[model samples]
Target: MLAVLAGCTGGSRDIGEGKPGSSGDAIQIFPRDGAEDVGPERRIEVSIPDGRLERVRVTRVEDARRQAVPGRISDDGLSWRPAGGAGRLALASKYSVEAVAVDAEGRRSARNTAFTTVVPDHRFIGYFKPENRSTVGTGMIVAFEFSRPIRDRAAVQKAIRVTADPAVEVVGHWFGRDRLDFRPAAYWKPGTEVTVEVGLRDVEGAPGVFGSQRRTVGFTVGRSQVSLVDAAGHTMQVRRDGELISTVPISAGAPKTPTYNGKMVVSEMHEVTRMDGRTVGFGGEYDIKDVPHAIRLTESGTFLHGNYWAPADTFGSLNTSHGCIGLRDVKGGGGSAPGGWFFDRTLIGDVVEVVNSPDRKVAPDNGLSGWNLSWQAWKAGSALR
Candidate 1:
C-alpha cells in the first residue's frame, strides 16, 4: 500500500506554462473610474513610478469639451500636475481622463478613467490685482477685493500668500473686512517675480459662507521709478533707481487743502476723465467736464491730472485749484504736454513721494498707494504677525 501511494504522488499533473509576456508599469490616476461627488476644487494627479507621462488629456463628459488643464511632468518622469500644482474641476460635471506613459525601458502604458465633481451649495471667490501677467513699477501691491465681506479676517489672510522669486518677507494688511493688501516692508525689489496664491477653497470665510477660490496670479516688477513732488517748491522730480531723470514744474493743492505728504503709488491712469468737485464732497466747487491725462493717486478723489482750464502761469508759479496736483496740457491730451509725457512714461505702481507739504500723510487704504507707516506699525495692522 505504501508503494502504491508513492507511485500516485509521483504522477503530478503538469502546471500550465507561464503566460507569454507582460505589460509595462501601470500608470496611476487619481479619482478612480466611476468616482462620484469629488470635490470640484480637488486637483487631478497622475504618476507612474517606473514611467514618464507622455500625454494627459482631460475633458468634460457630456459635451466632450476639452478642459485646458495645463500639466507639468516631473524631471524624474514619475508624476504630473497642473503647472501651478493646483487647479479646480468644473462643478456638477463629469470628467474623463486618459493618460499615456513610457517606462525607462521604452515600454508604454495607458490609463483611462472618469469621475464627477460635487456641486456646491455656496461659492465665493476673491478679486485681486495687479492683473495677472502684468508688468508694473516697483511699488505694486497685491490687493484683493472680495465680493462679500469676510467675517474671519485671520483665516482669510492665512489662505492668501504673496511671494517673491528672490525671496522677500511679504506681509498682509487688511484695509477692512472685504479688502486685503500685501507688500514687502519697503517697495518690491526691481525685476522681482511676484506670485500671488489664493487657497481659499472650502474655507469658512463668514458664518456659513464658504470660499471656493484656488488660483495663482503673477506679475513682474519693472524698473524702480519714483517721483519726488516738492509741493513747497512747486516742482516734480522723476527718479529712476534714485537718479534724477527729469524735473518739471507743477502745482499742488492750495494752502487751505494741501496735498497729502507721503509715499503714494500710481494706482490708475486715464487719457481723459471728468473731474467734478461735487462728486468728491467739495460740493459744486469745480466741475471740469473733461480732464486729460489723469492719474489717480488715492481713493479719496486725489488725482494728478492735466488742468487745461487753469491759467498757464499758475502751473509753475502758484498753487491753484482744489486739492489736486495739476500739470499743463491741452484738452485732448496730445503733443508735448508735460502731463501726457509723464503719463506715457509712468506705469501703475510707480511711487509718488510728496514732501514739504502742509497736509498729513496719505492713508494706507487710499487706493494701493501710501506706504508711509513704519514697518512695525504696518505689521501691527496685520491679523497674523
Candidate 2:
C-alpha cells in the first residue's frame, strides 16, 4: 500500500494550475501594464491564445468608480475587449483592470494591470447660444464661441453637428479662429426642432490643448418675422410672411459713425440698460444713465433702441446719434411708444436687414451676422465642405 500511494502522489496534478506542456497559453493586455499618458478615447482590450476569457473588470482608482464596461469574446474565443457600454475614459485618471481566462485544457489564468492617461496641459470650452431650450425665430443661427483660439479647426468643426427634425441640411461656417456658426442655406422652417451636438471631448484642439465638452442642445423655431430698414429712407418696414405689418419711423447712425449695413439678428432685448461709450472703444462720447427698450444688433456696440433724450422730430426724417437706430420713446419706457411696441413684437432670431447705408457691411463675426456673406461664400468658409 505504501508503494502504491507514493506512485499515485507523484503522478497527481494540482487543480487550478496550468496543465503540463501547456505553459505557452497566456493573456496579453494593451496599454500594457504600468502604461502612462494614455488617451481617454482609447479602448481597453485583452488577448488570449488557446484560451477563452471568463470575466473582466475595470475601475477608476480615484473614486472607485467601476466602469460600466461591456466585454465581448472573439468568435474564436481567443480575444476579448470592452465592447459597448464602456465609455471614453476620464482625463488624467488612473484605471485598474482585472481579467480571468480559461485555457482549452480547463486550466485557469488571471491578470491584473493599471494604466494612466495623459494630463491635458490646456483646456478649451465652447460657449453656444440661443440659450438651450429657448424658442427662436427662423433666421436664428446656432453659434459657438471658443474660450481660446482653436488651431485644429477642421477636426474641431467635424466634432460639432447639427440636425433638424424636418431634415434640413445644416452647415457650419467659421467666422474666425474662435467663432463658428451653423445654419441652413436659407431661414429655418417654422416649428422646426433643432438639435446641436458638441462632441469635442478628448479631441486635441492644439498642442497640449484638449477639448472637454460633450453636450447636446435642442431648440425650436417659433415663427417667421423679417424687418427691413432702409437707411436712406430712414424707415423700418416690418413684415411677416411677405406682408407689411407695421411701418415705424427711425433715426439711424450719424454720417460719421454709420450703422453697419447688412442683415443682423435681434440677439437680445433689455427693458433698461446703461450705455457707456467707453465700453465700446469710444472715449466717453456718450454715457446715458438709462437707455430704454434696448435691442442688441451688433457686438460692436450697435443697438436699435429708444432714444428718450433725442428730439422726437429727428426720429423719422434725420440720422442722429452714434451708430444706433433710435425710436422716439419716453424716459421711463412705461407707455406703448414706438420703441416699446417694436421691442414687444421682436423676438430673438428675427432678421433685421439694414440697407442703403454709407457704412460698410457688418463683419460676419459681429454678433451672429453671418448672413452678410453670400451662400457661396458662407459654404466656402466651412472646413467640412
List lDDT for all candidates, in order: 0.70, 0.71
Model 1: per-residue Cα lDDT at residue 238: 92
Residues 209-268 of candidate 2 have per-residue lDDT tens digits of 888878787889987889888888989999987789988898786676677799999876
- Candidate 1, 1-385: lDDT as tens digits: 1110000000001100011123222666787766766887688888887757777776563221234567777888788776663366766566667676766777544555567766455655565667677789999888776656788989999999889989999998887788888889888888899988888988888888788777777889999999998989999999998899889888886676677888888876766543444334453344443456777777666677676655677667766545577788876676588888888988888988889988888888877764887788778879886
lDDT agreement of model 1 with the native: 0.70
lDDT of 2: 0.71
For candidate 2, the 10 contiguous residues with the lowest summed lDDT are: 3-12
Name every residue pair that clashes in candidate 1: none
